[model samples]
Target: MPPRPSTKKPNSNPLKKKGPENKFQRQQQPQQHSKEEETPFDNPTNTIPLSLQQLLLNVFQSALVPNTSTSQDGKQDASQRDAIEDEGQLDVKPLIQTIKSHLYNRDFDSAFTDANEELLRAYALRWSASRTLGYAGVFKAVLGILSGDKERRGAGGQIVCIGGGAGAEIVALAGVWRDIVALPTDDMNGEEGEGEGEGRMELKVTAVDIADWSGVIRRLDGAIRSSKVSGSKRHPAPLLPDGKRDKFSVTFQKADVLSLPEGELKSLYGQGTVMVTLMFTLNELFSTSMAKATAFLLRTTDVVEPGTLLLVVDSPGSYSSLSLGKSEEKVERKYPMKFLLDHTLLSVAEGKWEKVLSQDSRWWRRDAARLRYEVGEGAGLEDMRFQVHLYKRL
Candidate 1:
């Protein structure tokens, strides 16, 4: 006989203990995937174009199921002994849930297994695509203003994304650069053609995370480059001032941001128009250890030069717990994310960061109904509501 339904109350902390099993679990049966409807690439919209989203899906699909081949004697090796599986048969919900559980439990190391890396990365990309676009929007807005400032011009500088190894930051920054170059010369403050190479405003992105997300970032880089070559014909690759293909380079560095020394961190920051991003990342650090987080901010300030920009995007809500006084007389308090960031970064004794932009809440949505890949039946992607804070080092 089939198992009966569970009657226990849902656990507030999913990581604490296992929840009751759902006997009537919904399964995502294999179904035909649909393609995204084409849309103009240069529409000046904050969201990712449908065609580009489709490209992401295509790249993910190819990675999920590569062409299989037999050995020399038509025999399979131990690795290939297991039968290959198609995308449809790949149960993504459990993998996603596992990742969520690991993250909730602060077990980041467990989330980086080879078996689940692709799925983990895919889930993150799908879950935060809108947030990524939102980041791009904020960057574009701020850079447009900074472009006019002679001292803060960051035309050919690097963008360092702490905890952005999922490659969202890379995609967003690439989009921003594309939009910038597509503009007329007069709008770019005439700094476009003065970079390392003539007419080449090279963008270097480094995605740093504790997890070994090198494979994921590598795949994403390939996909972005591939899209430029074979994507929508209407939107041919944008050209540099020298009439050459625009250059956007990205690399993945696996490291713990909180543990990096000042000199190493400075080297990573590089020079000229440097920007650092902490999308859905800062809160995690605070949650882990307020002391460590505070040290990280102080260390960052000491490393990065003045005029560097720091952009942080995270879920809009108060989810931080702070402890005050000694252990016996300790008092715990819950603080809002923005307040924590402000209190830490703004209240620093030396090298205080100037608050450039702060928004309590901002909504971002994307229409993923037409996507070629489905996460699972009844597992549609939800829109994001986040808070954004931008700062400039003094």
Candidate 2:
């Protein structure tokens, strides 16, 4: 009677209708949308779990994350988690089995190729960070020794570095030299004054190893360029009384620790102020003929004058088992740091070199739990401690 006004139903559009099927579809849509939006962590294509991802993320963040207020708690949390990850627990049998099977069944070459890439990647990451921090530690020690009144007396003067890889430590030490020698003590103390009458000392560095000559040269060139760009002052004019130009000079030679070149040794560093550093290279040197290796150690003292300073930094032998065991068949082996030190000290003593500093224990331990969490079971922690020895040629 009212012209069916209500029955016409406000001209409802079909699209706007809420039918049973529409309601059912609407209810299902959210679930489908959620599935499509899943994150890689949630649906990882590989066996790596979310917890492990968090752990790795924590490690990277801890190492590289710039310090900030919000990050303080994170840093602590990451450290604690890393400690747990370092423990010997947590099963990796399955992962190892998977890898072995893949290696044995598939083309062995491909499998090995992949594994090597992964290994290199891991080493590069860890070494880059550890080396940077470690170099900082070394430079701090050097400055402490250099700044002290005793060091300036030219008593116990040469610094020796073993196993100088990529020469990063050398670069860092050069920077320290620039900072110490270039800056007046007043500048170091955060105040400017009439520059002190202090003069810069001559630092003669010798880098020796069995690595490719080209690679070593490239690294040295880069380091020198970097030091120059950072505004390092060239050694002051008027050569020292010893007739040695007081410039930053480094001589690189290709010498195997096993059979060092005696002639080259005499020509490059025949008695002057020197400092020696040995890094991650001792193990390689040790595996060679012990007699030859011992001779090299003896020659270090022989080549330098009495009271030269020697600093040797190397990893403890514990971690060698992890990586070395895998490649043992291909490479010769040697004892850990303790044994190496015992032998080295005996050799040095026989060679008449006096030891100034010797620490057999390691200062840094790898977070085993974190490594296992990332690499899974077969992986173990490597102690990065060094038996630092400061020797005077005597």
Candidate 3:
């Protein structure tokens, strides 16, 4: 067969790449991978752009097949493995029940998929992964706004997203870092070239969650690195003002938000303009107990200084049914405001850290004509009561 004709016009003066490729470069930066124990996603095949659910589903399907060795020792080892897995499964029994209720009730009204397959694999997958682009824009705008609080304007800071599985927050920070370095300073009114090198900064983000998201995140980071390293005409990574890639590193840690160790919060964040995000997790926590959920919210606020930014996203509905319903009947609350109005927030409001951004998803959709953001594709509007809030300590 003959070679296909080129669709894109060839550039006369293409830029050359002068950075590290995926595995080799990753090896050079030992501190970045020091905390993680998983193998690096070096191969191109591992970098395919698949959703977290699909990747984990493939992992599960692969695990179902028996190993090649079928001797008596192998059988014993398999039994031991099964016993360990069963022990872990005991903790998720309640979650299994919830999945059963959702499926049996035929309540496909949620923004996430209604398929039985999806329901079964929900534990390993990230249900909120589809909001990648939307969150990227939101975080970009936010970092732009916070540029002033910088150690230097538009240059240095850190971002931490709670429950940021599958690298959604990583992608968002990467987009923001690139824009910061390439584009002129947002506050500067001069031409593009005026603020050159002013926005170059180092950013670090920590994704805290119980499930291991290293595989998917490594795949994405590897893909991006490969794209930048090749400087290929086929697919190129966006370059910074200095024609270099930004050092936006993402690290993952296994943690339970509600029960994080005492003082671990302060040790992790330190004293800086750290932006802590509790997206999608608050409402999920409320499924069990609002009191415990409120405790989780309070503990998050305890670590930050007067200027730390707290971003929250969750469903919005009255928890009155949960609090006021029969003693035996279970009612899971959906409102973020309830957490706000709870007595716990009173401590946080010590005449400081006022609420800044408060936008309900329903309100945005209801009045789309006057909205600031274009809802991403297939992001169900009605089912998700996606409310976003930002509080900055004074």
The lDDT leader among the candidates is: 1
Please list the C-alpha lDDT of all candidates, in the order they appear: 0.55, 0.40, 0.43
Candidate number that wins on lDDT, 1 or 3: 1
TM-score for each candidate, following the candidate numbering: 0.70, 0.50, 0.56
In the range 102-123, model 1's lDDT, one tens digit per residue, is 7577666676533356565545
lDDT of 3 by residue, 76-121 (tens): 1232122111111222234435655664664522312323322323
CA lDDT for candidate 1: 0.55
Candidate 2 structure quality by residue, lDDT tens digits, 1-394? 0000111111101111122222233223212114455322121112222222222222322222212101212233322332211212323344445445664675433332234323322322334323433443445455545645454633323444555533545554544454454334323334453533245455655666454333333433332332111111222211111232244566666555565568866765565555666665554455434556556767766676664556666543322221233554655444564355445654445545554444433343333454322333343233333434444555
Error of 2 at 88 (Å): 43
By TM-score, the best candidate is 1
In terms of TM-score, which candidate is stronger, 2 or 3?
3
Clashing pairs in 1: none
